[model samples]
Target chain A: MPIGIVSEPGREANEFKFITPDDEKLKTGEFVYYNVSLETEDEDSDLFSKTHKIFARVINRDECRGYPDSFLADPEVNPKHVAKKLGVISEDMELYRMTAKIIGYYDTRLNDFTNPRIVPKSGTKVELAPDDDLEKFLTNIEDVAEAFIGDLLHRNAGAVDIKLPVDNFTSTHLSILASTGSGKSYTCSVIAEELMKPDSRAAMLILDPHAEYHTLKEIEKMEEFKGNDGYKPKVSIWGPEDIRIRFAELSFREIISSLHNPSDAQEQRLREAWNRIQSSDDYGQYYSVNDLISECIPEDGSDAISDALTWRLRNAFDRELFDHSRNLSISELLEPGRVSILQLDTISAIDQQLIVNILFRKIYRERINCERNRDTQLDFPVFAILEEGHRFAPANGESRSLPILRTILSEGRKFGFGIGVISQRPSKIDDDILSQCKTQIIMQIQNPNDQDAIRRAVESVGEDLLSELPGLTPGQSVVAGDSVNTPFLCKIRERHTTHGAESLKTSKRWRESWTKNAQVPDKVVDADQDKGAEDREELL
Target chain B: MVSKKIGKVIGSNSHIDYTCEIYRKRDKDNPPTPADHSFGQFVYIEKEIDGKNIHLIGVIYDSQILDPDQGRTGPKLAEPHEQELFHPSYIEEKMTLAGIALLGYCEVDDDEFCSNEHCVPPWTIEIDDIVRTLSDKDFLKFHEVDGEINLGYYQNLMELAGPFGTDLLSKIIDQLKDMKPDEEKTLEVIQKNIEFSKRIKGV
Candidate 1:
């Protein structure tokens, strides 16, 4: 069914204006197309039909004709009635002029659109593109590796399932950018569930800063993820106390950053002791922070520098994380069909950065060794998602993890290592790190700086879609970049596992507490009040 | 039903408004009175265009009573009854003139009047064209175009009816509402708008 006719050329070359009486369906972001007859080059060069469908998106609409202003003067009289009295039909009263931007013709060979660099001529009939065609051409991905994340936004529910390729996003890196409480963690859980499906039994790691991903353990119990070949997925959770890093693995900078400001002489002495201990026979295999401290000798027969270094080292390395010869092995952290979550809710910000730095470095080197056919503990690929990515690779401040994360993001594709950075503040994340993730799932962001940062970094999302970000409700997102054929709005699917990061019910909890307090016996309350009065008198 | 002849076209002061002289009696009905040619009454003059019968529809907007013997100081020639016996054609000069504003036209077919009404007429009426009072049925049918109540000649009527065009249209719309009960609400809206415009424009 044809919806409208091309009225004239638009303000831009790739845009055209069409007149339509359909005020309901032909809204902004609607997909419509017109047929164009291609000029054949030769008589025998014919593999397809000459008539091709040129798709376009409706970008703007304006009313070109309506009832006169005077007809609407009387409040009680409807404008339609006035027009009817004047011998005009009700439907003919309003005429809308829709402006559409051409999205080019779909090419089967390329599985994408091929821009013809030409717009339809005037008087061409433009029809609404059917849902079947949109489902076929809008995305190009294999069905086997499809991660059924959500459906297309603005379309009817379940009209088009937006299935992204797990292979593309995992290999090239991915980012989930949204404001707080915008379902960032919920979308991540959905992806995790997809990865743990029977067809994909992917090895994954999540650096959960707030203990929000522990609910992923439910995947092991779900029947959907169990394979027919008796294969069941596994989830491993490591709390803050169990997350350890050997003291010897820290670099000179990492060690110095952990301490308060140290004098130049103390730093020099520490460096000397560090190098000496590193060259010793038992440095990496079996060593402790006590050894490093004991090795720091007095300079010029004075014990001032060594004594000060001793106190700082004891204070920084006394935590359970920096242990001696006790750290998680690479083989234990990553395995096929297993998800490992390292909960860092109890750790401080600086220690969290150092932990991420060490883990990423070890993972990168181990993957490289495995790819090169050398001795390695782990041989399979693994993808790690870092929650609150801005704390790891902040733009305004330095972090111990930023360099290694950047290195892994840039070169990890060949080595079968990938990173997913999830952050609420895109502007605070390093520009290079944010751009390296080729796949972006952007939700509602109210901050102008974050929106501008996305505009500058993400080239795939157009201005029209960017403007929709501020108005998007929770669970709606704009998926763009390599994983999708074109940028589009998506309504994220529900998570198979229960979400763990819901906001606390403050009002309900307060009411419950107040009710419980009111149920206390009157005699007990009087006794407590008498004791409180006696205690006040004693204090006075 | 046959249309009752009320008068004949006498003269015209303008192209759209024509003067018609009303008669005191007609053959098929009782003696015609002033009410037959009253203001806002539907009337038409039959004419032939290109060998086809057409009726030029109009409405009586104004009326005049001519007494040519007013203010005559001459001696009394005879009594009123004796004058009628002596000079039988003397009373003919005392006539009633009606000002008819042409609204539109309708085509006549077979025995039916106003088979299809048009808002614009291609021809004008002659001096002696017989003006007849349109029946209530034909009057309603003339306003019905394409099965809806269409006052397409609303602008023309407003322009040609002189100072009292708004009042005349209000009266016609009221009659139409009573005849067309289905379109009563919509016609009421139009009537309210006309009343509002009359008050604002002070016409």
Candidate 2:
């Protein structure tokens, strides 16, 4: 059915305003269509004798009441009474106008999309597009199940499944942007579930700040249906206790960048100590921070800064965190459809950089080697899902992971490598690297600066869509870039496994405790006494 | 095709494009105003020009109504002056008129009628043409083969059944539940919708 009549005409930077009667179905973000002609646009166009239907996304909605200004301008009548009258008068007083941007044309020939040029004349029809129509247009009517993430939420009215083309998206990298509690973890787990599908042939490595993705090993309860219903996931969990980076692998640049801040003399001593330790090669296999500090010597052989170096090294990190153990090979870390989650839940902020740096360097080397037929495990693509990216790849200060991460961003796609950087703070993340991620899955971001960062970084999604970021309810997101046929707003389907990282309901817990404690058993008590009786009680 | 009585064409203008005003007044005895004036409903006025059967399709997009001049007839309208209240004063009956914008004739330039196509006719609509909303048969016929508009906000607007809507998609699914194969995506959506509805009810 026609929802509105096209008020605007022609398709130069195409935009149109249509009066959508007082229908609530005609809303922003909905799709509408009108019949246009391809014949007029091209003289050689064949006489298909069909409607060259132009498709557009509703970006804005305006409401106009037919009431004259006299009602508002009148001071004699009570304003409250006037409002009541208007409410009782009728719905006819209100008019709804929908503004839509022409995204593209649904090309029936190629069965996908052709560059939209033809424009509908004034008074063309516009209506809500059905779910099946969307499915046909978006997927080109093919299953093409690459990495099925979620369903499209049609305003609490309808739902349809949607999938992403993973290989095409990985080259540009992806960012899952959301507010702290806006189903970010749930969405991430959905991606993990999709990747771990048997035919996906992709490996995922999650750097979990809260050890959330570690719950991928858990199977969903069968009583209620879920994604990970009956099968055991090929997932491994590695926490701080099971994690250690070999100190011998560290170069001078890596060591310097990893350290918090060292004075000129301290840096010299540290560098000299590392050089001496390398020369000896007899400090067993594993060398601690204490060992490196002990072997240090200034050029003048002074002990003035020895205590400072020792104290700084001891206080900066858990001295026992680093040890000279051979890092796990890529084969042990990654496998087809298997996920390795490094749980960094209990560690300090600085350690996140060190761990990511060490792991990233090893994966980079193995993948590069595999490319050259140099006997390595990473023959297939590896997707590293990095959480708290702003911490490791901060816009400001230096960090151990920054340089290695830069390399991965610049050339990882060429070598079957991609990274999914999950960050709540896009503004804090390095501008260069943040912009490099072409495919961005943005959720409910409320901060202005973060929204601005997204606007600057994302080129495909229009400002009209970006303006909607803050208003998006949880589980709703705008998927932009080449990952989708067109940049669309969709609701992610529910994950088969539990989103273990969900926030605790603190108020509910408090209320439940009160209810439970209300039934406290009566305790042994002394007989009640008056104020004066307490004085006589001692005598009694 | 017989259409549920929607409204009657009371006014029209062909100066810019074929536009008409539908007097959507309710008849207490036989009320048919509700379905007639909706913005997106496909409506048309039939015209026979030189033995050519023409169907000028249109959509009702706007509505307007002048406030009744109650000052001359009621207390509120007479607030400005005392003399107007006592005398026999009457205001014209206030009514709403839905504005209809013409899409085009149904294959006027072409020989064969394309049920799905929108065409621009060489002629405009006449003042005497009666405007009527599309029936379910015409609606189904045109929508099935004509155009399926796919939108970005598709997911947001779609609601699962038990609470039937203008689309009545849930009822359609319920009627076809046993007949639909399990392998189809349609079946999956229906099952999910049922589960979602059950969960919401339980909550």
Q: Please report, as a value between 0 and 1, the fraction of native contacts recovered by candidate 2.
A: 0.00
lDDT by residue (tens digit), candidate 1, A137-173: 7777745487899988878889988888888889899
Candidate 2 chain A TM is 0.79
Model 1 alpha-carbon drift over 4 Å, by segment:
A39-49, A67-82, A249-271, A281-286, A293-320, A324-330, A522-540, B1-203
Worst-scoring 10-residue span by lDDT in model 1 chain A: A40-49
TM-score, chain B only, every model?
0.87, 0.49
> What tens digits encode model 2's per-residue C-alpha lDDT throughout A417-461?
888888999988898788878788899999999998888888888
lDDT of 2 by residue, B1-203 (tens): 46644555666654313444444333345544655665456677777778766766655555567555644453353444653465333322455566665544553335344543333346666664677776645543432221221111112213211132223333323423433333224333433444555556569
- Write model 1 residue lDDT over B1-203, tens digit each, in one string: 34778888989876678999887653335645667788899998888888888888999998898977786678767987788787767666888889998888888888466466446566777887889898888888888876778887788788888678889999999999999898887787778778878898775
Cα displacement (angstroms), candidate 2, residue B91, comes to: 36
- TM-score (chain B) for model 1? 0.87
lDDT of 1 at A466: 87
DockQ (0 to 1) for model 2:
0.01
